[model samples]
Target: MTTLKKDSLLKGTLILALAALVARMLGMFQKIPLDYILDAEGQYAFLAANNIYLLLLVIATAGFPSAISKMVSERMETGRYEEAKRIYKASLVFGAVSGLLLSSLLYFLAPMYATDVVKKESITLAVQAIAPALILFPIIAMMRGYFQGRQMMSAGGISQIVEQFARVIIGLGLGILFLSLGYSDTVSAAAVTFGSVFGSIAAFAVMVYYARKLKKQDARLAVHSSAEARAALQPNLPYATNSSMKLKFRAIYSEILKMSIPALITSMTINLVYMFDTSFFISITEQVYTDERATEAFAALGTKAQSLAGIPPILAIALGSSIIPIVAAAFARKDQAEVNKQTSMVLKIVCLTGVPVALFLTASAYSVTGMLFASPTGYETVAMLCAGTILQITMMTSNSILYGMGKQKQTMVNTIIGLIGKIVFSTLCGYYFGVAGFIIGSTICFLIVTLLNLRLIKRDVTLHVMGKKWIPYLGAVVVSAAACWGAEYVMLNITEGIAEKLSYLLTVLVSGSILCAIYGILLLKLNIITAQDVEALPGKLRGPMRKVMRVLRAGQSG
Candidate 1:
């Protein structure tokens, strides 16, 4: 095999982020059609079932991928390819057993879970339909984790695109077909849920193909290495024996679990919060509204608004995912400087992207919701949720940094505290304030978690993120958001009766574009992002950044 160069951490992150963006778009599109096809009742059922599926899925596999990636990278850094391969093999076994067992449990208990837990009998079929995907997804996650450990991100990226593509085509196609065939809404929704199974299978095939190709290359490299070693009379060198291999496997397994369990609990926090909403929101809303109205409210807040609000945070997720292995490798080398540098850069980028997106979403909630989801029913909820998005993005990046530094236990503790806050706030707020209350609860939960994680990260590393320098960035976002809000207000008033939907779309598109441009210009002018920052961007982004810098310079010179 050709010797692999160390991947540029930023480039790897950008690749994953681009793929994540596409996947998130596909996910949003899937929801739009599904929401249209199924009424609010069906959408509620689907989302309720999905929450259960996500919780189980996270419990089964979320942490292993990051743990495997970190472990594999650490081993590879020391030239222990064989050990890394052993770690991968052991993880596959663990993934298969756990995935199948959990999948079986979900499949068998779908009725009870839907009825007793979610209090929605109509969701049972959807839960069952998604169960098989859980099995395949965990295995696929392990494969992706292995590749990520090797710093070969293309396999994971390609598989993600393929998976999302297959999901959109198959899911929407099947849902429409089933609806056309006059199936019950539950059945039609279940058909859409099957798309997860098909998508996971597609993703699995892609990963397997890549794995086989990699194995061939590794085999050739191994043969060449053996020949060279023999020729060099390296007979006394340390080589893996069967007994030693068993000991190594034991060590790897223990370490894997040690690293993965806390991470698993930390990841499960988000799903747990969602599960809380699903179980409580509808019932709580029914106290104030009719059952039908409650279902609509649930669909608006939990399904439509939640999905739309989640789009911007994909950047943070991608950044966090990429940070794990990169920071892990740096930490393994005891390079505190590199670790701090990567952590700070990741935090800065998250803030720079997150703050503006949060402010824009909050400011343009009505128009954006109208344009994206065909109505602004839950615009207030979405606006509130955007605050949580910023907090959650920052918290996720912080958690990744902690995980990289082997601080999963502390992160898990913080997540548990946040989870408690979520349960208490969501329940209390939902009972009194309905959907808006759930949104507020979520914001509080994320804020608590983020602040706690930030404190821990500060103690762990010399991170200087969001310092005095970030004030200008915040100022730019605030000014731009205010300008966009004014522009939107004018546009809405001017286009009131001619075409409401068209007006909303135009207001959002035009205002969003102009304001974002203004924000970028202000960031440049305020020196919030200097030339060094522009140069630090990936090559593709650096050119545009440089052009912005040039414009700023010209404005100053003139």
Candidate 2:
């Protein structure tokens, strides 16, 4: 039974990790063709429009899904199955009503939002196009919360993949078609905005199917039980209650709202930072540029650059989301050791993932940006943006960990500092350096917030966890930088044509791979990853790591 439980958890974590990888890859790859179709100007309009919609989506669904998942899990644990259903149903209704209100407001106010706030008349149409997605997206969230609450993650995985893929595919196709037909870039941008609505529709359909199937299975199980067994097995359905369904719905909705409001506030604050940046930066850039067309084009450059820099957040969300449930469960069991262990592992994994990604991005920024965009401005801006990832990943991970440890107020305080730092630095830098300033400001914000949180975590958690692990991580990163530089030199000197790109990729891969391998071997040889460490790795990863041991043995023998 213990083994079975362990295996299930490993599988779940693996699934989450794999899904996250796919989502991140999809998000990054989506930009390749988009850069070609829209140019940076069109991208700016699209980004501007999409950022607003994204913020709205967060407001509508931010904390509800996670909170609802936790609530349902508790109810199910106590065998209150009917209560779980009522809660879920109530949540869905609330999502629908809220989505409608938000979507309508945004859609109708698009012109004001675009012209008055963003200072881009082009964005007005794009806002209208994306408005429908605001309505559909929350329903998808509700169903996802329901399934996720039941500890069924596969459906969530499938829906997220499909939703993202559909958006990319449809958006790209329509953007190309509109552009080819000689529509203005602004119109083409609006078409791309509308594609998300279609994607959400498809995703919502799938979630509904899954929810219904789950319900039917539960019904069948209830029916098959004998009278006495049925009584034992039956969930507490509120159907027999004397109260009207409407009253019951209202009560459930109230409960969900109480849990979700704080989440909404938190999410709104976080998302609002980006919205504020987009609106003000784009408006100010437009004012600085003078020419309407030039302003549009320049704004798009900043938008695209921001998008490229955002890849780290995608991975962070995946890791952070999975971490929360595990931490929460550990907390429920009052297992301090498990909580600390998981927290440490998450931090290590974040560094392990973030350091290499950021280094590679920084090292290959020019080639990567060149490959993705036609304009030199786009390339330069994205390269600048790429530089921010190192700080962003570290800060983001630390903040997530703070939240996991139940340090909400501290998290808010740290976030406010970061946001304030971003605004001040961004304004100053943007005035002087234009697009580069934004990314630099972002990096500064990340560094400051991360350090602040690190201090808090050390004080609160009763351990000097950050100081112990961070030194080695930084050392490894510095070594990686040297290795990547050396590898780049070799690739440029020795490789040609397809051979050139392939060789550069391989050399870079090898350089980072070797650095990581050496780091691990040193950690093991120095007693970092001891026998206990080997035992702690997931079963699949453990077997392959044994080969590392064998290779080390052969090296010693030789």
- Alpha-carbon local distance difference test for all models: 0.78, 0.66
* Most lDDT-accurate candidate: 1
In model 2, how large is the Cα lDDT of residue 456?
81
Model 2, span 176-202: residue lDDT tens? 899999998889988887878887887
Point out where model 2 deviates above 4 Å: 1-21, 56-62, 79-82, 227-251, 262-273, 286-304, 313-315, 375-380, 460-473, 489-535, 543-558
Clashing pairs in 1: none
Please tell me which predicted candidate would have the highest TM-score against the true structure. 1
**Candidate 2 at 445: error in angstroms?**
3.3
Model 2 lDDT, residue 298, Cα: 52
TM-score of 2: 0.82
